[model samples]
Target chain A: DAGITQSPRHKVTETGTPVTLRCHQTENHRYMYWYRQDPGHGLRLIHYSYGVKDTDKGEVSDGYSVSRSKTEDFLLTLESATSSQTSVYFCAIMGGAGLAGGNAYEQYFGPGTRLTVT
Target chain B: TQLLEQSPQFLSIQEGENLTVYCNSSSVFSSLQWYRQEPGEGPVLLVTVVTGGEVKKLKRLTFQFGDARKDSSLHITAAQPGDTGLYLCAGAPPGSARQLTFGSGTQLTVLP
Candidate 1:
């Protein structure tokens, strides 16, 4: 509902193949993030972007790469897919009211992309 | 890595029943948030608690932050079928606004 969308809502790829998922937002928020959701792991941050071309790795950034060349789009790429990477991927933008005079803790997430690597 | 542990990985209750979900951690958090996610969709923000011993209510749902800022709880009164979903709690550590530590989540199924 925050004007966010993820491409390739569902996909099934074979192992060792390259794959990419895209997150697009119209809110123009300064922060964007990539997350993977699994049954027992909850939601894990994979990567995040603070500004155009400025990005940082998150807790589970291994086996993944991201690029944010523009404010509206952030891409997550898996160089070689693996069964361990099969999970629901979500893209989020951080905005709204927050504490410490910084961006709030609220995150607006996209519908999510379901990637299945066999 | 700071981890938020949630209890009752899975729950099932009949409609109109009362239920509570817990989120706990050993590290202190500057703020905590709750989100509900339904099938095939992303999680949606429910409420945010920033102060210790703070209580906030959203309709039949009540949220309380622990007195020590290390835990929080969600109490649902007369739960409905629509309340069935995955509930997640995320905490923002002190001086950090760029990221949050999330709980593994509690999946609730309110049967009719």
Candidate 2:
């Protein structure tokens, strides 16, 4: 979807282990976001990046950290994975201009990465 | 409590039947977006409504944004088997980052 690629499409990890998910975009979009999807929760934003090396926490940022050293890549890291973090992770890139045209913005999603923790 | 709550969490209807899903929120949003997601895939953007009381149509699907900017609805006419999927509604509040708060979503099954 929209030239976005997420690595490790499916992964099974143990609790307390460190895991990292990668999102790569070819569109050169200025904004990038990481979200998690569960059964009851539709999609919760974990973190977002407005530009390279500039990151901010989202509504559900606890226990997760993100880094964006390059414009085309955004990485989400689970410092210590937990069973509660087992869910489908999606990467999205925001399109359109700056805040002036924010109303016209649209988010394009990646295929998604499924992580299972035991 | 969810910022945006979607009604009829699960819906099943016969082919050719009509149905509507509602999403309500207490907070006023600057814009609302509709998305359809299939199994093993991320949600795809269907439409985005900005102006209050705005109505947009994409073929058989009709989407409306509430005048108060706190609610929205999606209506499908003459549903078909291919319409089976999860529908999600997301809202963008008036802010700088332009982040979105999503609804729990409505799962629909159009049985033939």
Candidate 3:
């Protein structure tokens, strides 16, 4: 298990409210990713950060945004929460960017945060 | 879009039974990884196969990457209740190492 933790293990909010999920890692990994897991959809990437202030959108980045101001924290924000945004959000870290051998690209995930929009 | 399609969306079996879950894709991948996720928890890395036609085993679980590098399979022999969880397969494309295209996943329940 990696030293990764997601704040707010569970949360419930209204549809129009704004929500932010936080991911903190103690490993100081180079790559950090945010993903959502829903039934029949598996895990879909929302955003990822390669370094401080360097982030990119992913396959399911329509309504989500991310920021990485520091090395240890990656934040995912939902500007206005929607029922469709309810899902288990996960944070993961990879030591190498597919450069290191011996499964260095393999990701280590946090426990996950469950969000519900009513 | 590059997609990894997993079969047997839902599975239920008694302990000691044997089962296989598959992940297929049309695009070749640079590497393939399998993960097992428990309820309320993140997916944990089970194994990664980078070489085509590679086979790796971990105790009762056996994983194989297709020779084409476009598909993979996971077989569990004499399943136990501890195996109950969601099994996801993700493929890494060449060049970019940003995000992984994950399969729909298979929810497996092993009843004791």
Candidate 4:
């Protein structure tokens, strides 16, 4: 492992409960992202952080929020977990801004965290 | 929206067979990448195609980027059970952040 880990590899919770997932990396990468993988929809970005205290929304950020307090840790919080949020969540990191011609900008993903909302 | 579309959502073939997976989009990309994901795991990068019309091979796997940079294909020769997984294609548009727009993906099963 190049140094990316997600907490609570698996989880089960009731709907309407608040939940948080954590992503940690030791590579000191500048970019970190959170994505959800669902059947037929593949992986959809939920949020991403470029640096500590800097974050932005992704295509699917309606019910989700992210916080990056340090360069090595990014947290994704679901204020109210729902059945629809029951999907595998992945954390990824890249060394650079991923500009074109930056062949090494490929992201390295962590082992996914499976969440079940009942 | 710039979306990547992958075809043949599912494929099943016998060992030693040859097959191809495709990723297409109307929007041109600055670069494209292919990944393979197994159950309960995150996708692992297989290859990245940057130049239009470029081709790269990794062992028995062949990757091709369309001349227009709007599509790409992955061809596997002599498929094996080890190749069973979900194949995904992702693209990074020019001038945009390195956020990848991924295709739905292709689930491939190779029977031994």
List model 2 lDDT by residue over A7-112, tens digit each: 9899999999999999999989889999999987899999999999999999899999999999999999999999999999999999884232445578889999
Put down candidate 4 lDDT per residue, B40-94, tens digits, no spaces: 7899988888989999999999999999999999999999999999999999888
Give, for candidate 1 chain A, the lowest lDDT window spanning 10 residues: A96-105
Model 2 Cα shift for residue A3 (angstroms): 0.7
Which should have the higher lDDT, number 1 or number 2?
A: 1
| Deviation of model 4 at A102, angstroms | 4.0
Q: Could you give candidate 2's per-residue lDDT for residues B1-112 as a string of tens digits?
A: 2399999999999999999999999988888899999999999999988888999999999999999989999999999999999999998887742698999999999999
TM for candidate 1 is 0.97
DockQ of each: 0.62, 0.60, 0.62, 0.63
CA lDDT scores, all candidates in order: 0.93, 0.92, 0.90, 0.92
- TM-score, every prediction: 0.97, 0.96, 0.95, 0.96
Docking class of 4: medium
Any runs in candidate 1 off by more than 4 Å, and if so which?
A: A99-103
- Of the pair 1 and 3, which is ahead by TM-score? 1
RMSD of each: 1.5, 2.0, 1.7, 1.6
TM accuracy, model 2: 0.96
Per-residue lDDT over B69-90 for candidate 1, one digit per residue giving the tens place of the 0 to 100 score: 9999999999999999999999
Sorted on TM-score, highest at the top, how do the candidates line up? 1, 4, 2, 3
lDDT of 2: 0.92
Ranking of all predicted structures according to lDDT, beginning with the best and ending with the worst: 1, 2, 4, 3
User: How well is each residue in B1-112 modelled by candidate 3, as lDDT tens digits?
Assistant: 6899999999999999999999999998888999998887888989888888989999999999999999999999999999999999998887654468899999999999
